[model samples]
Target chain A: MKQKRHETPLEAIDRMTDNSVVFVGGFGRAGVPERLVEAVCRRKLRGLTIVSNNAGSNVAGIASLLQEGCVGKIICSFPLAREAVAFRDLYDRNLVDLEVVPQGTLAERIRAGGAGLGGVLTPTGVGTDIAEGKPLIEIDGRAFLIERALRADFALIKAYKVDPLGNLIYRKAARNFNPIMAMAADWVIVEAAEEVGIGALDPEHIITPGVYVDAYCAVTRIDQMMEATP
Target chain B: MTANCGLSLDQMAWRVAQELQDSWVVNIGIGMPLLVPPHVRADRDVIFHSENGIIGMGPEIEGGDHVDPDLLSAGKRPVRLMPGGSFVHHADSFALARGGRLDAAILGAFQVAQNGDLANWKLPGARTGSIGGAMDIAVGARRVLILMSHTTREGEPKLVDRLAYPPTARGVVTKVFTELGVFAITEDGFVLEEIAPGVCADQVRAGSGAQVKTDGATLMVPPDPVSPREPVLSRA
Candidate 1:
């Protein structure tokens, strides 16, 4: 097995291009790849599609990209918040496309993509507008709507710890969407707050195994990144 | 202002807390439902789940000095973990919701129709709605309870005949607790079950945008507590 490449945040994000579908990992600000997001903004890539839980809030993170008009569309569960002015403004002007999904369905779809499944059937949006135009199947006389798996060209994730072999463990609620997105992306770049030796992470505690991660960069300048808006 | 005419926000939260049974796993949404945790009966063992991933959530950390910067609720506020609390990933958190593990979900809403349809995620003419986890929790939880004021900030009734805005889910709301009264969705319509002190059925009917049924039923008044306790701040 090849060792996981260690790259700078800039070098890792440089691999992304225009119109790429990127899965960003974070719940609010807990597990966001701050440096990677900053690098994406600096690169000025446009017409990109982003999948995440929320459009980054008023603080930093993906909101900077939204402010810069780098994102053409977003597939997310929570697309708006009082603090998400950048997203709200862009959306109001028809500058960006938004597909609002239920949170559970969103997670399942991403997980399915990673697991190589055709699709999963869920009852989440059966009677709501979310079910509009989706195929409905009945099993045992119960209704379920088919939700396709969500895979991205690149996944920008944050982890509490990453071993040189690329295994990951997350801290507290920060674990949100990072683990699953790691599996579903063509290239996974993680920003780990701390990087340990290959054997440093215990097998039982590993949330994401080494095989899924392609490249990782240590989070050196936490203060500068964390100070950015949500 | 009608002095002491209805339940205060805390009183409404107190009433909503009364509805929960012991050992039930509950997901509390933003706004009024955030107030439910502090008011729950101390004797009952209720596990609080935040959609962001932490379960067995306790009250907020005091003074903002001791807060763990990484620990936050679904609402993005600092919260303490109760004993036996565990964390899961986002997918698993929703699984707890979608897999029918959550016994009840107390959510806030913009409008609740007589048929139990909820219109809380969006308003009319908004470019994009913040659906969040409303639809998932609305349909996934075993029971859906809505906590909101009877009227909008403009004093317009939120209990309506039909929704003017997009619904979070269809026919999911089981009960609605407002400052004015407790309304349950019946086959007929919204039936008033109880009234707060200083408010009568006629007042509730007049304030409601939809018709309220009060036939052949006595409207019981909620007991007035000597003093409402200060609610423990948990999540924002």
Candidate 2:
């Protein structure tokens, strides 16, 4: 028989070493794994290189970590959406390091990370200073973008439910960045609302399979929330 | 006014073509400017570019039946391709923008100036701002045309003497359009080009917030009218 694998969201995060690269899933606080985010927040991990689609707005979530000095660098697109408070400050003071990724390339990079590819070829920011000094490759007489693969020590996302076996199901826009990050991390953690025994849920509904998951924890709701009004 | 939009939209489209015809390549920034493709005179040839890498783009698909996953417009919506259409590397598409291959670009503006200074990227009080390829297009296009309303929601003029917010491109704009009329940036400053059928030059100037003068010649309006199609953008 195979050894059983299980852990709480906090325990999953506890497994992370300080200053490690982390891949988080969320499109501006939409599907962020609350339990894991809280644990990382409380853990106060420093010098962390974080990757995500958009940093959460001011209240809590990704931007919250920036407030606590927990994040050292970020790779993302449109970091300063309407509700983004911390990012503007960090940008103004030159405190946080940011690498601008064009919107489409940002999505493809995450997908590339999940596909087990070392890097993806793209031409998004080539020639006119977008990808200058970065690696460039031509395939079939056509230029393609060559962006490096990104992996995280810990990956986090919200789930509607997860099997004890670690398969995950997400709800709505909540699916935004969760499933992709799951594929690109060494350890995948889910902070789900319900936990069920394996085989109790439909495999079709599962966004991420247990094959990539390392730990999970059940939680009521993520403490962080952000919007234009918030 | 075209079918779904206002008279302003049609006037702006006409002005854009007047300034940009014979241009080898162009990319209309997303949003209102995205609608310009259908309005452009089919007889005048121009190679259109979309940020999503589709060239020689045509009117959008109504039902999205063929929905090519491999190709979509910058909006991520399914779009039909023209006969000679081709897909380039997405990176190459952007290279065309940054590399200065375009002759003229017509973009929607949040604000413009008497001298055609532009601010279309960010709002100061808003937490986030969009610089999406606008910076690249504005700087690279040899002639930049701004399609915009005369005033903001606050009743302040969009055509200010100077830009109110940080500008994505500096001094690249060539013209402006409003419900009031059309104005072109000239060596001296904003010179009046036309006043809408019922509006006066002074009224257009007052709303524009910049010194305005005219060649004092009657303006010619293109007769081939455009009908705005219902927006294909689904409610997000």
Candidate 3:
């Protein structure tokens, strides 16, 4: 079995290149890969596209990337949080590109990318601005908008526990977007709270099976600002 | 509109909460809709769905020592999970809404047109706004209930004949609960289903941008507004 575990998060995230499309998993700070995001910020790579639920808030997480002028485009569902001044400033100044997708469609599109599907036809965005300029198809007397699959060069994700083989589980609502992102990216780097022994995690309870994970690091700072504080 | 003329915000939330049926899986949207779940009757067994992957979610966790930062609502407020609660990832969680598993979705709105068209995501000519999960919940839920004030703070009616703002979905809203009363989106138009105690049909009509039919509408006399911990039953 391959040893997926790495000595540190910075080393685990060593393969990310400049101008890469990255998937940062989280929903309003839950399940966010803070340490990996910090590592990417530390690397100061430029012109990256970030796909996530929220465009990072003003202070932490993906905001650090935007603060460093590293992002070129952002594809997300909501970018208008009160503290998301970082994204708003750059977007208003035309310094970055923005594509707002319906939250469900974003998830389905990523899932389609990982599952080897062509695209998704969803009713979530029909009759709205989201439907504008997108291909519309009528099926069974209902309209559905065509959303293309979204793939990334790398995915930064957080997990609760991982085994030597990289099998993973998440705590509470922190599982948002992490598992699917793990499959959608070419390389999946995980920052987990604990690294357990193989076969220690119950097979029935594991959320992301080890085969999808490329590299993993066990984080010592367990409670280090995982949530975007209000 | 006068300050004392309409139901309080909590009263409006209680009115909306009363409409939920037993065993219904309901998705509560952010903002004012967040106020509805807390008022839900404990006996109703209404499973609350948060877009960020919590099912059977409980109330917001007040500041405490043991608050797990990972456990949060879609609104990002720390919350607790009920005994039968379970968690799924983002895709599977939204599948519950888009796949028609939700019995109802209670949401906050900017405008609800007479024909049940909903405009909530963004304002007209705004540079940026958040769509979030409002669109999915609007089109996929079996029923959509809206909670908002009868009029904006500027006193402009939110229940309109046509939407000036961008719509989240068309012909999706089943009912709307506001400070003035409960308005059911019927085939005819907005029908005044329940009027607040101090408000009259003329006032409701004046407060609505669309025509409001008050025929056979009943008066809603709620009991004293209390903390959400206790059920605020209405007079039968």
In order, the Cα lDDT scores of the candidates are 0.84, 0.66, 0.88
Q: Write the per-residue lDDT of candidate 2 for residues A126-203, one digit (tens) a residue.
A: 433356677888888956558776677778767767777888876533555577778878877777766788898888
Model 1 Cα lDDT, one tens digit per residue, B61-114: 554445665678888877878767899988888989988999999999989999
Residues B1-236, model 3: lDDT tens digits? 23458898888888888989988999986788888876777677788899999888777767676567888888888887876788999999899998999999999888999999999999999976899998988999999999888888888899999999999998999999987899999999999999988888998998889999998899998766635754222212
For model 1, the DockQ equals 0.51
Clashing pairs in 2: A80-B128, A81-B128, A121-A145, A122-A144, A122-A145, A123-B91, A124-B91, B1-B6, B1-B7
The TM-score each candidate achieves on chain A is: 0.94, 0.87, 0.95
Q: How many clashes does each candidate structure show, in the order listed?
A: 4, 9, 0
Task: State the DockQ, from 0 to 1, for candidate 3.
Answer: 0.59
lDDT of 1 by residue, A1-230 (tens): 66565667888676789999999999888888988899899899999999999987995998999987789999998887778888888888989999999888899999999999977899888877788999999999988999999999999999888888889998887888999999999999999888888788889999999889988888854532242111
* TM-score of each predicted structure versus truth: 0.92, 0.57, 0.96
CA-only RMSD, every prediction: 3.6, 10.4, 3.3
lDDT of 1 at A27: 81
State the TM-score of the second chain for every model: 0.91, 0.84, 0.94
Give stretches of model 2 more than 4 Å off: A1-8, A136-143, A222-230, B1-236
